[model samples]
Target: MLKKLNYTNGLLNQMKHSIILLGATGFTGKLIAEKLDKDSVTFTICGRSLEKLQYLTEKCTHNHECLVLDVMKEEKIKSVLFQYEIVINCVGPFNLWGNFIRNFCVQHGKIYIDISGEQSFIEQSFMMDKLAKEKGATIIHSVSFESCMADIIASEMLDSALKYSDISSYYFFRNSKPSPGTKLTMQLSKHFPTFFIHNGKMENASPLAFHKYISFDFLPGFTKALFMPYPEILFFNKKYKVNHSASYLMLNHSDAMFLLASRKQPIESVDKILKKHQSRKHNLNENDIAKQEFTLVVQAIAEDGIKITKYVHGRNMYGITAFLVSYLVKQINSGLLLKKGIVTPSETGAWSGLWNVLIKEKLITHVQELQSDEK
Candidate 1:
């Protein structure tokens, strides 16, 4: 459940001395750092390797600090984290490496955000709402492409619906591959629980459950979407008071078959197989990035029997994630986010704001509201 909706103006606007970018040497981390640099946000890049940190700093147009601290070293991580008021953590699979850092941040009342979509990690973070509130900490998880965009869209739809009974989000992606960090999360998350909201309660379920085919009005044919335990399910139901909330990921026949086959294998065996696949990294060229597309369809059924559907389509997930991270930083740095506690993007009262920005930036190629009779 969300804390009280007490949105504040930029209370910390004058406190933007420095922002810390943890896991700065990773793929998504580098993208975020580059975006921050381009936006003229002063930040420090941190990782275990001084060489890689220096390399990233050298590419920045603006002056930025670099710190070489191993993630496993608790003291070092704490010392560096304490020095900055804001911390952007791109470290993952967060299910393994997230608990300590988040705990420290919450205890110290620091503003912490991470590009994590792991359901378990997010759920764990949500449990700290009380501590975060008492400590005056603002903790936001899954501020990346996987959840933040969808969360914002859902919030907008829910607000329009006013009294929503059911909400569902369908994610469609084409010609895109998961980053190494995402792959690692996928491999490790098998051990975590998958759940959904039903009648205002959480129910555990199997991964890729509730298989169904959906035909979109803007798209060509029927696409297969399976239930995926995305963080949006929790946020939508909790924040919007929706009785039922569901999230689905579009998959192809081959992908479905692969997932089903892997489900039957032992966890160890599956990890090995995934690791082998992860070894072969396919670099996406310009054409590949252009071909990669993402579409999100959010439908909410109002208590009054009205149905509202909204969708947003875009390309290049990584670029969008980077942009979203930077945008969140700007919002927090400007003290636009006034809530103090565990929060999602929408709960910050900036969902529509981010939605407008996405459209204005052309990151969202299409935004539409379909008539009830349409789809």
Candidate 2:
């Protein structure tokens, strides 16, 4: 059974003096850092490579420090992390690495953010909520494209429906061309088994844990890949007073087949295969110059038989994630988030605020109203 809703309060908004990027040299880490580091907040970029750390420093016009520490060196990293006000973990294949920081953060009362969206999100997160509260830490994970966008779009569509009447059901659409960083992260994250939160309870499952096939007439039929069950569905399910909530990916059939087939393989076999594969560097265009695309669709059904759908489509998932991360930093500055606990993007209104920014920036389109008779 899922844990009871225990949303606690009383977290002081303490902006940390320095925000440390754990996976500073990676693609998403680089982008988030580039986007958020204005001349204002101080950042300390930490990773395994001193050379790469120095190389990344060149990209920052703003003042930022660099530290050579690995997350695997949990003790050292945690020591540094607690000293900072906030830490952004760009490091992943997190399940493989293990979350020692969860305890450290909870025990120490630090503000932590990460780009982790692996199937093991809550398996690694929720277990630390009480501990975090005990220590006074606020932890937000999977704040990137995977689940954050889904939650925001889902919430908005549901909210728009409430403006008319009570909501009964909803659907979310996610179409995004992931950056090279996403691909590498996928490969790294696949090192662990998949699991999810079932009825607010943590349960073991496959990585491509659950899914369905969906086709939209606007484009060719794409396979809706089963990402780990993100909190978008669960959070909105409760928030909107709906009985059912589902979201699907907008992906090519080939990619879906590849992902599913890999999921079918045993973790041991997959790791062996990865070891046997040629040593190919992780990258999309081998450089950050390449752009990607992301599409968002949120549908809500009201008791009065009305549906309102919102769309946020744009290019550059890395850039968009960066934009949202920057916004969250601002929210942190303003003290909107609650006390120490594992949080998904949907749980907070980061995505709601994100939708506004995306729309205002023309990163997303306006709302489209559909009759209940329409699909």
Candidate 3:
């Protein structure tokens, strides 16, 4: 049996309030650092390069510290982690370095957060859930623009629609470019099997099966979406008890074909190429980010054949992710999120609060609900 830590409100505050950002020099990491600084949140920026870390720290609007540390060095990583209450990991291809960081956090009883969208990493992390609970460590994965947006939206919709209906399916449609780190992670995760929840069980499915077009009531015309293994399936299935759920990425027909063709190449070679590309500095411009948008649609069916659909539209995936991370920190600091264990954003009991924050920040501009009677 695993041992449990004695946690009080004071201990929780002391252990879950402070922040440390790993990979602080990366694109998303830098954005998160900037937001934290803008919010005047006390945090330490850590990475392997002192020069890069210092450069980022110098640009912060508020005072912050920088640490030169390597994730591979377990002792050093653990030592540094011990000093902070929470660690916000902006590292990518989490398949490579996430396990070590996660293990250290669990063993040390530290609260951990990551914006990882890799399906394999999320699945592997779920195995640590019991251990994390035992240690009173909260590990939140996929707390980012991709999965969290879908997770929270689906969760909130389900909570409201559960009274008169059961969720038959949920779909996510995103229309935005991915960051370099996201590209790298996608390359590394291409070989993993795609999955969706069916009958309360995770089932493997072919990506090619989702090539068909889907139309949203809120959006004009039909848009092509491809099935992808998303962390939301794992997060929602456990909590919502949905019968079937699948996530799709919006893509044009040509892009869909290219995706299929690219899978034929050797995974190792592709990963090497992506890694090289990621090594270069590719920051997104404000104008380009301003043009980005995302849409999520949820469909539920009542026993009497009434179908209900919900939609949420948002902007700037990366910016929204950074803001969401900082918002979560605020909640943690305020003692609003103190659950001892691995939890999802929806499970944090802060969805309503987060929704309000998202609206307040103007990150989300539209929300709608539609009901139709079908035979």
Candidate 4:
């Protein structure tokens, strides 16, 4: 028998003005909660840890609540279903957890959103769109830092470009420092590859399934990066109908090592690698950034037979990520319906339509046009 959650219909409706935050104990999750608090929106922390959840909730500023509702249990999900209008899923690796929360929210007509950056998990999020819509629920996937900012920027750039030219190719380059929470989530996800997203429609490309080496001036002439094929690339490529596509990556030691260890291995084999290699402890710091910068470069081919390029830049990956998510939450809450399911940042044109929002929210420092004569 599954654990029965104590929060019921009365408690849910009582949450008239609150957001339901799943995985509230996470590093990034805590930060999302903080942002919500500052927004003056009500929210509840729902995780498997009652004591930890309680402890987390106790320190919050707004009218927040806590619930011991694990994603793995259905009955508990129902007990808490009627309480909130939106469910902000901050848990990862989303390959496993995405489906659980997504299903519950859609089935119960709860607006569901998640910050799952996993490509594989993102594919699964797309799969749920039809059902979610039929059930009259808004199911938004990839509402996190990685692709959200890119999505908004690209959408705006392309929208403006399309009015004047055709967008032939688009690329996003990103790097961010690790918050203690993000670092911890990465450690847990590697061993639990079930969190990986896969389907006959969307198969996991084996490790290095996608790769490319590109030169960038963000730092100097060139920096070597192992460009892994990301699932969200689908959102951009398919939407733009661009034949050429790639998402380059440069990960530090732990992230790079984890990606290397999880590639193409069976579940048990992957677990073995994690057990053998993972450290059980760490000293966490709030201010430590993992030495990163994520910049987006978009090249649009004008029907007039010219290639126009635009560049966008940002530092502070985690803060920027939260910033992006917070911005997205507001836009989404304002009766905007993204009827498209399973798209990359480029496909959803809302950002292009809402570029000022990105600037207003400070997600992108600048969007500048590069000289066409340079390259």
Candidate topping TM-score: 1
Model 2 collision count? 6
lDDT of each: 0.77, 0.59, 0.73, 0.56
Question: Rank order by TM-score, top first?
Answer: 1, 3, 2, 4
Best candidate, lDDT-wise? 1
Query: On residues 1-375, what C-alpha lDDT tens digit does candidate 2 reach at each position?
Result: 111112123211233445777887777787777777752556666777777777777767776766666677665665567667777777665665537765566677877777666655545577667777777788777677655776665655556335333222122334334555455546555555554334434345544666766544443565464544444544454355553444455567777777677776645555654564326555454233334445555555565566665555565556666677777877776767664566656665554455567778665554443445333
Cα shift from native, residue 244, model 3 (Å): 1.7
- Comparing candidate 2 with candidate 4, which one achieves the higher TM-score? 2
lDDT of 3 by residue, 75-111 (tens): 6676567767798998777877788988888887888
Q: How many Å off is the CA of 22 in candidate 3?
A: 0.7
Clash totals in order: 1, 6, 0, 15
Q: Estimate the overall C-alpha local distance difference test score of candidate 2.
A: 0.59
Lowest lDDT 10-residue stretch of candidate 1: 1-10
lDDT of 4 by residue, 19-84 (tens): 778877776776677777676666666787777776666667665666676776766666665567
TM-score for all predictions?
0.87, 0.75, 0.86, 0.74
lDDT of 1 by residue, 1-375 (tens): 111112124122223346889898887898899999999888877787767777777788887766666788787676667667888888887877888999999999988889888777778777889989999999988888877878887766567436667788888888877777776677766678867878867888777767777767776653777888888887775677677777888776788667667778666654574567568774644355556789888888777778888888888788888998888788767778568998887777645466667777777788888747323
